[model samples]
Structures are given as C-alpha cells and as structure tokens.
Target: MPAVRTTFRSQNHRGRSCRDFPALTVTFNVLQLMTIAFVWLLALVPLTLMALGATMLRAVRPAAAPPGAG
Candidate 1:
C-alpha cells in the first residue's frame, strides 16, 4: 500500500512538471524574439541614415574631374 501511494505521488509530480515545461519554453521564445527585433531595429537605423545621407550628397554635389582634363 505504501509503495502504491509513493508511485502515485511521483506520477502527479511528474505530470505537473511536464505541464510547466511548455509555458517556460514559450516565455523564453518570446523574450528571444523581442531581443532579436530590438537588435535588428537598432542596426537598421544607422544603415537607413547612411543611405539617406548618400542620396542627399549625390543630389547636392556633382562630381568634378581633375585640372588637366581631356
């Protein structure tokens, strides 16, 4: 009788632990996704500004050849 009770207790504990695993995994996945999105946005800002600056410079300044031109 004691052995049967112990087995039932262990089974209940195992079932609860298993149920909690997916919730922990989903939380971790959400945090990782948020971190990746933040890093991507941080990187994109500088690149976008650089592209805009290049476009503006091209519009404002025309290229000049050397003094001894053909």
Candidate 2:
C-alpha cells in the first residue's frame, strides 16, 4: 500500500482573503467586464457592417450579364 501525497495545498487565510483586497479586486473585475464588452462590440461592428454592405450590394448591383456570351 502506498501513501497518497497531495500536490496542492490550500491557503488558510482566516479573514484576509481576496475579499480583503477590495481595490485590486474591483479594478480587475471592471477591467474584465470592459474587455469583454470591447471584444463583443468589436465582433458586432464588423458583422453589422458586412450585413449592411451585402444588403446594399444586392440592392444596387444589376442582375443581368453583359450581352456577349452564348
């Protein structure tokens, strides 16, 4: 029989955990939210532009080909 050894140990901070680190935690959360929003908006803008361009091209381009092919 072999004894099992744990590779990870949890820190037993009695009361001064991440909750105690208010400014850094709040800043990190705010930055995370902003980054997510920025990435989402970045994706949305291009898709919206592509959709608008496709619609405009479909509306304005002629359907018939030039009169030369048989």
Cα lDDT computed for each candidate against the true fold: 0.79, 0.82
lDDT tens readout by residue for model 1, 1-70: 4654445456547547545689888898999999999999999999999999999898756555455662
Tell me the RMSD of model 2 versus the true structure. 6.4
Candidate 1 Cα outliers beyond 4 Å, as residue runs: 1-18, 62-70
For residues 1-70, could you state the per-residue lDDT of candidate 2 as single tens digits? Answer: 9997654444565436677889999999999999999999999999999999999888766554455642
What's model 2's overall lDDT? 0.82
Q: Model 1: how far is 48 from its true place, Å?
A: 1.1
Report how far residue 50 has shifted in candidate 2, in Å: 0.5
Give candidate 1's total backbone clashes: 0
Which candidate has the highest TM-score of all? Answer: 2
Prediction 2 TM-score vs. true: 0.59
